[model samples]
Structure formats: structure tokens, C-alpha cells
Target: MTSPQSRKVSEPDAVKLPREIKVLVAAAFLIAIGFGIVAPVLPQFAQSFDVSVAAAAVVVSAFAFTRLVFAPLSGWLVERMGERRTYILGILIVGASSAACAFAGNYWQLLLFRGLGGIGSTMFTVAAMGLLIRMAPPKARGRVSSLYSGSFLLGNIAGPAVGGLLAGLGMQLPFLVYAAALLLVAILVATFLPAAIPVPVHERGQAALKKNILPLREALGLPAYRAVLTSGFANGWSAFGIRMALVPLFATAALGAGPEVAGISLAVFAIGTGVALTFSGKLADTWGRKPMILSGLAVNGVAMGVLGFTGNEFWFFLVSAIAGLGSGLMGPAQQATVADVIGNDRSGGKVLATFQMSSDLGAIIGPIAAGFLVDEFSYGVAFLMATAVAAVSFLFWLPAKDPHP
Candidate 1:
């Protein structure tokens, strides 16, 4: 007969997520869809104001810069207002900012509106992480993380194509569409989510009711958490920032491909990520978080290291897909580790926010640094920089212990 513990690891499908998580997953999908709709057009939209390419690029950077700056405050709000309220408020702010962006009269106005959206983005992002930490079953945290991320991934995959179609109507039209999507998300969460999640019978008491904020200092004491932060930054650097900024340039400059090929390569990457998400979560639970994380880093590192050297379209696409797969493998395990450390009983708003800030910081800095490297040396050098970041993260994880259930 299978032991219960063995079954828990092997048969993750038997673990059911709570209704709140389902609601959050739905919200994640909508948010990703909205964000994706704006992403492809935002730079072009800025260029419409007769700005230089560098100036237009700054508009994109402004949003991430703000997110990194406002992250600590977002964490404080999550602690003060609770996750549901903070989430709703955050989305509402983003929705309103998107509307403002749609009607902006000039470059500065558009920049201001876009930057404001980042404040709300971080607010909700941190709160959502808080919610996941508190609500996910310890045993099923990886599965829960996978479901939420997968929803976002699907929405992201679908949104850009739709956004491309919507852009034909008018550039501003996509902004309006994204705003409407966010409004719908705000309404859905406001109507369906509970004010307070009920704790288990054993946990319910005065002790549970009190706020138990996990200080950033305390969280940093854990070697695994430190590794998580390192990996988060690396992931942001390579996957979030560098991938978006460098991939198209590399496709065109290195492979002698057209713009369409760049788009296809990105799509292929996302599809590869989707494929890995299908099974990685269950494996993270069964095989352990450390192994999954290290494996992901190694795979992503090597794939990226070799990306610049791919001489043909086929090889480039294959490497891109593999990098995406590595990224997908890391997501659930890294998130579940954070959840494990924080646990359901404690508030980790600051800790979660700091972790988020690490990623945001990477997203902001990675491209700028890699861009310099690319300009000075070559695409191969930039990609190698990414590989180095991943290797450093792997080293961080080496001594860290895996989380226990």
C-alpha cells in the first residue's frame, strides 16, 4: 500500500485548492491579459509623440522604476489593509491609470500615467503573493503556484495576438481595452472574494488574529530565502528584462531574420514554458524544491549561454524554447519555497515585498547593463552576462537547505 506521504507527493491532483485561490487564479489571468495587451504597443505609442528611441524607452523604464521604488509601501499597505482590500484597490488604481494613459495629451502626460500604473501594479502584486502564501495548502503550494502562473501564462499567450488585432483599430484602443479588462477583474474580486479567510480549527484563536509580520531581517536569516532572492533577481534579469529587450535585436542582428521571426521565437518560448508548467509543479512537490530550482537554473543558464552562438533559425528557436522551459520549471518551486518559509499563520508582507523588489530591480537594471554589454562587445557577451547571473544564483542555492512540509 502507498504511504499517505508518498501519495501526497505522487498524486497532487488529489489536492484541491480553496475557492479563494480559484478566484485569485482567475484574477491573474485577467491581469496578465491586460498587461500583455499594452506591452507590445507601449513603446510605439510613446514614439508617436515624436520622442527619440531612448526617450521612449525611458517611458517603459519609468514603470519598472516606480514599481521598484513603491514596493516597500505596497508591502506596508498589505499589512495594514489586508490582501483582498489591497488587491481590489490596486487593480482599481491600475484601471484608472490605464484610462488616463488612453487619453494622455503629450509625452510627459503619458509617461506620468504609465508610471502611476506601476504603483498599483506592485501593490496588487505584493498582496497577491501574500494571499498565496497564506492560503495555499503547505503540501499543495507548488501546485497552487503553478495554477496561478499558468493562468497568467495562457492569458499572456492569447493577449498579444488579440492586442495586435486591436491595435489596427487605433493604438489608444488597446489601452482602453486593457483598462476595461482590469475593471472587470476588480469587480470580480470585489464580488466573489471573502473579507477574511477562516483559519483551521487548531489555528483559530487570539494568536491567529494578531498580526505576525515577518521582518525582512528575520527572513534573510534563512539561507534558502537568501538563495530565493538571488534566483529571483537572476530570473528577472534573464527572463523578464533581457529576454524582452535583447531577443528581437539578436534575432535580427545575429540571425539575419526579419521582425516576424522575432515574434515567432517569443511565441515559441512561451509555448515551451507552458509545456513545462504542465508537469513541473507536481515534480517540484515530489522531487523537492532545491532540485527543481537548481535544475532550472542550470538548464536556463546553459541554454542562454549558447543562445547567441546558434547560427540558424532552428537552433535559435530550440535554445529559446529550452530557456523558457527552464524558467517554467523554476517558477512554482521558488514560489512554494517562499510560501513554506512564511507559512499560513504569519504575515510576511515586507519579506514578500523585498523579494518582489529584487525581481523588479533586476528587471530595471538587467536590460540597461546588458544593453551596454551588447553595445560594447556583442550579443554573445550580453547573453554570457545573463549566464553568469544564473550561475551566481545557482551558487547561492547550493548551500541552502530545502523547505520542509
Candidate 2:
């Protein structure tokens, strides 16, 4: 198999992108904004339906479940329809579903709409990534990946504050705001995005769909691809799941901080992540991916260990910052590594879809596992478990060489 670098040498035109890259990145920013607007409010909205905390969490879990199931299929759809059309359709679906979510009268209704939103998200996300990998040059891939990751982090940072403010207006107000954002996203996508020429009719009509389903073994056999998936899983597990599960509980119960204090702690952690990512992409490009991945895992391990011991609010925030920094360092490397592995193959779409599925899977599993450990033992046990997972990821990186090299 040709390496991504070698492929770049052979086909120079593959590195030269059309002007649509900016539009795709803008779509990513908009999607993140929509998601962020809902994240902080969804649980409260679910609870208004008289659901339990775990049940309310199902609102999130349902979204992940649908994304996990549909992500791979999205690749096939993008191949059949072309990237631009798929992206526009996805954003429209998300907008419509989010709008419906605002009017949902029952828990099941909300769950249904959120699941639909997840399907939309999967299509948009996979197609956008395919566009990015196809358009960016290998030399600039790291920076592009970092900027892509940062856009979402920026959205995340802004979303919660916005969501909190909107929540003050009414419980359903945030959903309305998210719907509006999605509408804007859909409009931007449709207006600014040019059509991605479909593969030749003969090429796509018979061969494309058949080629869409890359065997899991074959996909996983690619070392760089596997590494990115592993890193993505570790990231989502630690960053999204475990952090959300442990941080607030630890702040409120162990540190005796009020809700406002705990919320600020979370915000500070996200700020650290966003700030660290600003430079992390450039570092990965200059220093190479291995050091960034290994060092990030190590920092994440130490940060989790620190959280296991610290009960002070300030200390908790400090440890969270370290963990966020670790995530910032790793996230861009993981994305670039995926492109490195898949290169310019049409498989880029499927490869990224599979890679992203791992994160979704980890997001689904991490909190449940951590919550069980916490319930069975203590929050200390949960943090220790997270530390162990980080440690395992570090070990995974030890023998792993960067394929991009």
C-alpha cells in the first residue's frame, strides 16, 4: 500500500484544494455552535419531563447511539450523493430535528428528535472531515486539524454560557436558539458551499457502493488509522465522559463548592483546552506526532491522579486544566494521523467515520463505567480508574510509530 506521503509525491494535484475548504470549516463552526447551545440545557430540559438524572442522560446517550450506528453508513451516502449535497442535507435535518425538540411534550419525544439530530450530525461530520482531508496538504494537515478541533472547542466554551443565559429565559428557549443556529448553518452551507463533483457515474454506479464497506480488519490493520482511533476513544472517554461524570460531583460533595463554583471550574477547564489547542497543532507539525501523543497521555494520567487526591476547588480546577491541556495536545494529532493513514484514497470518508465512531462509543461507555466504579467504591476509585485508562493509553503509544513519518 502506498503511504500518504508517497501518494502526495505521486499525485501533486491531490494537494491542491478548491476554495470550498473555508466553507466546510465554517459549517463545522456552525454545527459546533448548535451542539454547544444544547449541551448545558438538555439535561434540565429532560428533567422537566419528570425523568431521573440517568434517564435524562439518555437524551445524550440516544444521540450518541444514533451517531454510532449511522456514521459508517454516512460514508456510503456521501459517496453516492457527493460531499456538498450530503453536508447540506445533514444540516437541514439537524435544524428541523432541533426545532422539533423544542416542542416535544414527553421524554420519548425529545429522545426521538435528539436521535434524529444525531443522524444529521453524523452525516455532516463525516462529510466535512472527508472534505478537509481531501483538501489539505500533508505538510499543513496538522494546522488544519488543530483549527478544526479548536472551532468546536470554541463553540463548546461559548455554548454553555449562552445556554445558561438562554435557560434563564425559559426551559425550551435554548432549543429554539439551537434551531435558529442550525437554520443559519444550513443556509450558510447551501449558499457558500459549491458542489463536490461526484465520482464518474460508471465508477460510482457499481464500484463505489460496493467499495464503501471497508472491512473492519483491513481498516484497523492500518497502524496510523488504529492509533488515531485509539487516541480518539481515550480522548472522548476521558475528556467528555469521565470529566462530566466526576468533576461536578467531586466539586460539590468532596470540595463543598456551590453549583456556581463548580460550573466556573468546568468553564476554566474548557478555556485551558481551547487555549492549549491554539499552539498544539503547530507543535505537532514541527515536533512530530509521537512526542505530542505520548506526552499528552502522560499529562492526562498525572492530572487524573491529582484529581483523585485534591478536594480543594482551586486544586480541582488546576488538575482539570492539566487534563484539558493534555486533551488539546492530543486531539489535533489524532485527526492529522487519520488523514496520514488514509491518505488521498476515497476511503478517507469511511476511515474518518470509523475513527469518529470510536469516540462516540467511548463517550457512551466511559461515564457508565466510571459511575459504576464510583457507586461500588468511591469517587476516588472512579478517578483512579480514569488514571488507569490514561496510563494504558500511554503504554499503547510506547511501541507505536507515526506512519506520517
Candidate 3:
């Protein structure tokens, strides 16, 4: 097949976004909504099967674990099929899996279905990010990242609140709804998202090969890429691993707050992240990426560490919001830096996938590690440990060069 237009120019020179990027953003919105619909119910649903807390937790990690294992394959597929097809297939798999989860009669069945869904999650996530870096111009890359992430966050904001209500109806109901939502998303993405224009034949062999496998050897040599790996890990550990796994429990046990309080704290965090996104992208575009990356790591480390010391709900809420804002500050810059390092290439699939893998690994490990600490020592100790992880990530940034500069 002939490559269309080949994006003959670098994104920094392009005046507007490609059609597929916009469509992908819309698809992200739909998928996030479904994820949100399931988020509030997944654990509770697992518990309903009379499983242990650890077993219930497995229902959650199984997805991330599989995603971690299969991310490389997802990168390979995106290189071969192009982002559009890969994305649609990923969504379809997730939808099918979610629907199967709704009917799962045993704990093992639920676990298996969730694991299946994780494989699909890796496919769409890596493919979509790869597509974004391929298309977004350097000057506007930050803003584009913000918009795409913002769409997902906005969906998350709406999803949990609705998911809570749906759970009240029945635990299985949310899964069915999530499945249906994903199905709809797949259909929309397939219809509206255009095929990526092929690279020129002269560049095809190398580009296609790169898409299938990552340029690990070359990427590792770049300080900027190293920094991205560091930031991705810290972000997942502090932002998601701790926040999702420990925050609610901390709110309930330490602060004496109800479930509603945890929800509010998370909402506050999301709000801060959203507000920061409004200008974070523009700042990254103008100020350079390293400064943003460094500041975000430092601020998040401070915020995370403080979580262990807070005694009241107000303080807990405030710190959570601060951490979220730190994430906001770094999110666009982090993704933009990766895009800059890859520098308009398809062979970047492996690089990007590896970058994504670092974060997913953190997300998988962070909670388990923190939970172990909490069990062995205390919540405060767990929080402090997570803080140190963030600090190490910041230090990694110290010597790293900014590709945008």
C-alpha cells in the first residue's frame, strides 16, 4: 500500500493536528468513561465472591501485570497494523473481556477476564501514545498531550461518581455498562479514525522495523530518555500506586473520614491536575521540559512525604491536591520529552513502549510494595517510602538534558 502524504514535514512545522489525533482523543474519552464506570466497582465486585483482600486486590493488578508483560507485543502490532487498527482491536478486546467479567461466576474467572483486558489496555495505550508523538508538532506537543490527558481525566471525574451509583444497583451492572461503552468506543474509533499515512518506501524498511522493535540501545544513551523513564516510574508509584491503593484506606483508618471523603480527595486531586493542564502545556512549550520535569518531581516528593504526617482530613485533602498538581506540572512535559527524544520516527515504537512499561511497572509494584510496608510497619512508613522513590526520580533528572532545549 502507498504511504499517504508521509507527514513529509516534522510536527513542529505543522500548523494543525492530523485528523487521526482528534479522533483518537475522542476515543480516549469514551474508553476512560468505561474505565471509570468500572473503577469504583471492580474491587467490591471481587470481594463479593468471598475472596481475601489480597485476592480481591489481585483482580485489579492482574490487568496491569498482563499489560506489563504484553506491552512489547502491543508496540510490535502498532508498527505493523498502524495505530488506528491496533487501537480499535484493543478496544474490542477490552469490551469483550469486560462483558465476560460481568458473567464471571468464580473468582478465578474474574481474574482471568481482567487479565485478558490488561493485554488490550497495553495495545491501545502504547499505540495511541505512539500515534500522538508521530503527529504532534514539537511546539504544540505539550498542549496536545494536555488535551489528550485532560479528556481522560475529565472522563475519570465523571466515571467514578456514576460508577458508585451503578454499583448500588448491582455489582455486575457496571461491568456490563463498561463493556457496552467500550464496544461503542471501538465502533466510533474504527469509523472516524483514519489510517496512518505510510512512511516513504525509502524510509519504510527501517521505520517499520523500528515500529516493531524499540531502539533500546540508542535510547538508553540519551540522558533525556533516562529522565523520562525515571519520571514515568515515579509518577506511577506516587500518583497512582499510592493514591489508588493506600489513600482511601488512610483516609478511613487514620483520619476517621468516610468513603465520601476519599472520593472528594481524589476529585480535588483531579481538579488540580486539570487546572494545571490548562497552562502546563504552554509552559512546557516555552520554558523547556527539564525544568518542568525537575520541579514536578521535587514537589510531588514533598507532597507524598507529607501524606504520612497529616493528622486531619483537611491536611490530607490538601496534600493530595498538591501531589496531583505536581503530576499535572510534569505530565505534559514528561510525554513531550519522550516525543522529542524519539524525534519524529516510527522505529520509536519500542522506545515509547519501554517508556510506558517503566510507568506500568511502577504502578504494579508501587502498591504491592507500599502495602507490604503498611502491613509490616505503618501507613506513615509506607508513605515515606513512596516519597523516597519520588526523590530518586528527581535526582535522575539532575544531570539529564532537555531535548526540547
Candidate 4:
């Protein structure tokens, strides 16, 4: 078998994107930039209310908690409302909530706003995903997936560094900026994006009757979906959870660092992710999803382990970059696996929701658990635990069978 890294996607082939797809990618980049802007500061913002570490962690997980419980609802709304309306509404909701968070008077208020924002987050996320799966052409799936993910990756890379600078200006500035960006995107989406009609409504009912929305039971049985879920869980727990929630606190408590360091660390991870996405899709196509996922998991686990042991800010940045690199490597392959499972079928709303649920569940649980671990023992222990969780996710990946590969 040829190595995944050796796969060749021609330059012209890679750039051939539909007009609608470009808009979707831009929308993804805008949302990610907004979220990335807030990430490094949200934890410390919670701490401002004299909340405990666990409480601070809750601020992060609250978004995921709402996402976890409401994924089904999001999917339902997408079906009823159509992707464009749902996507717009989702953006507006988050924009309003984020603005509220920026002006929140107390810890509880901030938490409330953050939690509410998750509902909007889930709405747009699911809608965008639904669109991407159907819109991305089969021949250019690899390139399109890369671009979609890459847009967010690049936004994340820029957002954190800029957010850090903004944080220095005012802690609330990042939240406000995020709110503004989201609202602006909502306008852009409403104004410019025409609906992506994969199938006419009349035909959709017939198509829908042909296949019931893929059930969780059915999704769980597919080796590829299961593997994709496992990878998502690990990323949510380890990268989105521990790394985002715990690392800044660790930097402050252990390394005498500040917001700049925290923001830079997260930015480093985005940099690594951005770099790998440039080639990961083509690699996944040529080499197979399995090898890329395995390589990514191994690299991510090792980096997480190293991060747990290191004390210096430089080491923290280096290890965080490595973890991001790993995430980038696995991200597209796992996402492609999901698209493969769903195909061009219009009945995958529930199936996609269930797949998303795994990641949200991990994000919800990981930080809260890690925070408690930190309270019980130390930051080092919490990170090591994340590494262990990521390591175990591979077991699920092993039995997966990729259709393309």
C-alpha cells in the first residue's frame, strides 16, 4: 500500500470549489475565528468572580453541555427550517449571547450566557456540516474537506494571537469582538448565501421515505462511524477539553505565565494544525484513513504526555504545537469517514447529530473531570489523564473499515 503522505492531488483539481462551498468555508472560518478569539480568555474571565478552578472549567464545559443535550434539537431544527435559515438563526443567537457574556455582571450571569450560546453554536455547526456533506463533490471530497477545515484552522491560528493582544486591552474585549464577528457573519449568510437545494422538497419526501434518518443504533454499528466518533471524543477531551481548559491555568500556576503565553500556546497548536491540513486530505486519500488516524493519535498522545511533564513555557508551546499537528493530521480523515458514512443521502441528520454528540459529550465531561483532578492532585495529573484517554481511543479505530481506502 502506498503511504498516505504520498497521495497526489493536482493543484487545479484542489482549487475547483463550487460557489456555495466557498461561502460555507468562509462561514466556518468566521465562526471559528470568533470562538478562537474567546477561548484563551474565557477561563480567566470566570476566575474573575473568585470562582474555584472547577467553576472556571464549568465556564468552558457549559457550552459543550448545552451542545450535548440539544444536538437532536439542532438536527430537528435544521430539517424544519432549512440550512440557510437555521444557520442564520444560529449565528444571531450566539452573537447575542456572546455580547451578553461580555457585559455580564457576575459569574453566574456569564455562565448562563455561555451556556445559552452553545444552543446557537450547535445549530450553525450542524447546519454547516449538513451542507458540507452534501455540497462537497465526491471527486474533490478530499480537497474540499481540507479547505473547509483549513479555513477554520487558519482563523484559529490568527484569532488567538489577536485575541491575546485584545485581552491585554480589556478582558471583555474578546467576547465583544466574538459577538460582533458572529453577528456580521449572520448578516453575510442571510444576504449572500442562497439555499443549497440538494434535492427538491417534493423529491426529498420520497427520498426520506426510502430511508429513515439514520438511527443512532445503525450509526453505532458502522465501523467507520464508530471510529470517527472515537477520534472526535479524544480530540474533544484532550485538545478542546484539557488543553484549552487546563493549560492556561497550568501556565499561570506552574510557570508564572500570563494571558499572552496562554494565547500563544493555543495559537501554536493552531499553527501546527494549519500546517498539516495543507496535505492531510490528499494523504488520507492515498494512504487510507486508518494509517493517518493511527499516526495522528500516536503523535497526539505522546505530545499530551510530554505537556503533562514539562514546566517551562517554551516546552508548553512546543508540546502544544505537536498536539495540534496530530489533531490536524487526524481531523480531515475522520471527517471524511463521517461523510463517507452519510454519503449524499438526505436522511443523515440524526446520524450526524449522534456523531457530533460524542464530541460534545467528551467536551462536556473532560474539562469538568480534569478540573476536579487538578483540585484533587495537580495540573500534571490532569494532563496525563488526558493523554491516557487519547491513547485508548485508538482501540476503537483499529476495527474501522474505510470505503475509499
The most accurate candidate by TM-score is: 1
**Which of candidates 1 and 2 reaches a greater lDDT?**
1
Candidate 3, 239: how far from true, in Å? Answer: 0.6
Off by over 4 Å in 1: 1-10, 200-209
Weakest lDDT window of 10 consecutive positions for candidate 2: 196-205
TM-score per prediction, in order, is 0.96, 0.88, 0.90, 0.84
lDDT of each: 0.88, 0.76, 0.84, 0.80
* TM-score for predicted model 3 compared with the true structure: 0.90
Candidate with top lDDT is 1
- lDDT (10s digit) by residue, model 4, range 1-405: 766544444332643556777888888898888888998799999999999998997888789889888899888887677667888998999999999999999999999999999999888888888777766665556667788989987787777778888999999999999999998898787777776445322245554534335566777788878778888888888777777778887888878888779878877987888888898887876677788888888888789877867878878899999998998888877777777776655546667777788877777678889889889997778888877877788887777776552
Q: Put down candidate 2 lDDT per residue, 227-278, tens digits, no spaces.
A: 6677778878888877877788778888888887777877777877887788
Which residue pairs overlap in candidate 3's backbone?
Answer: 11-137, 210-347, 214-350
Query: lDDT at 9 for candidate 4?
Result: 45
True-structure lDDT of candidate 2: 0.76
In model 4, the worst 10-residue window by lDDT is 6-15
